[model samples]
Target: MEIYVTIKGKVEPDKMAEFNGLFDLMVAGKTGAALETYGEDTFPAAESTLEKVLDKFEAAYDSINLESYTLEQGKLTLNFMGSYALEQILPDLQVWLLACGVKDVELEGNWV
Candidate 1:
């Protein structure tokens, strides 16, 4: 079984450098086992065990189909479907943006 999820968010175009840096970290393959998408547990230091969570997020972000995804101006949208549990990876999407905040998220298909 798999799920299709769409995430949308907003970020200042001026802050793209910071956003891209964080995003690049995820794609670079750093690994973290325990990290939260939001709240106090977010944004651990580079050496912190929780920091590896960025790796997990990058994998999921990379998994997004990208066929219908868009990131331009101040808007960002991504759509992808996979067997991975959304709870396991979806939060990573939100975590990528230090300034861009998620405005909406949609999920389709059945989940277990």
Candidate 2:
């Protein structure tokens, strides 16, 4: 089966690279370093890591107003139209997002 996933968001032009790097570090289990580099004030290590990431993104990039994920079949496609930073990091970001909520995952066309 093929699945498509899409994500959308916005990021500050200056902090775009930081945002992408943070996401990559988080996914690689380098949360400690990420927190240190980005400062723990915004992205504190705690429950709901996804929420933390989102919160940090929002703070860093006030322009980020939309973040969405869509899945269809086995092909995972991420669309971060609003966020240029996210667009660059889509490949890794998708994998991390899926890991966040694996149980609630649903196949495309599968009705809840």
Candidate 3:
């Protein structure tokens, strides 16, 4: 089975790199080390581990005035879908919007 998790948000262009980097790191491996390396002020301490990451991610989405986030958890895999408006604050932010149309699907849900 597979679970899906989606996050949506509007962010400045310059911040897209940071956001995508941190998000990728989280999906790749939501570990303390990973958070410490990619996390920013919005990211919580890694002490709580994946729980903290999820909490922080949720908060971040809320802060960005996101449209919605959907999470589906299954027996074997997890999928994420996110949708948000495009911010014109910076040109770089468009990078993150590349996945706006489709959901991000990760094969495993180690945190779950």
Candidate 4:
């Protein structure tokens, strides 16, 4: 099945630098300090942690495919084909996003 997982959220302007720091680092293809090692609560391990987390999910769930990933200030959308349910993905994502300074995290999905 193909699924669209849409995440709606906000990150306070003051926190934008925190979120952007990680995003920008990843977008620039750089490595950052691990979340556990970093003093800041925000997850800076963008390249490693994010993909590692997703890899863990993919390993546990067969037939999981990631099609698209999109992120912006107020919205995030992930498209994929998967046998696993949204429950398997959303909670961890919610936690990580919040730690990354994303507020009001919400998830919705459609399958086809």
Q: Tell me the tens digit of each residue's lDDT in model 4 across 1-112.
A: 5456666677666665665554454434343344333314465544344555556565676423445445666454444445455447667656667666677777766755
TM-score of each: 0.43, 0.31, 0.34, 0.51
- Can you tell me which runs of candidate 1 are displaced by over 4 Å? 17-68, 92-112
Give the number of the best model, judged by TM-score.
4
- Model 2 residue 19 CA deviation (Å) reads 24
Decide which is better by lDDT, 2 or 3: 2
For residues 15-92, write the lDDT of model 2, one tens digit per residue.
445455554454454545444555444433322545454555555562222233333332222233334444333444
**Per-residue lDDT of candidate 1, residues 1-112 (tens digit):** 5666666666567755544444443334322232233212333332233343345646557333323455578576655555563557655544543323434444443344
lDDT (Cα, tens digit) per residue for candidate 3, span 1-41? 22223223444554445555555554655535555554434
Off by over 4 Å in 2: 1-47, 63-70, 83-95, 101-112
TM-score computed on alpha carbons, candidate 4: 0.51
Q: Pick the candidate with the highest lDDT.
A: 4
Cα lDDT listed for each candidate: 0.46, 0.40, 0.36, 0.54
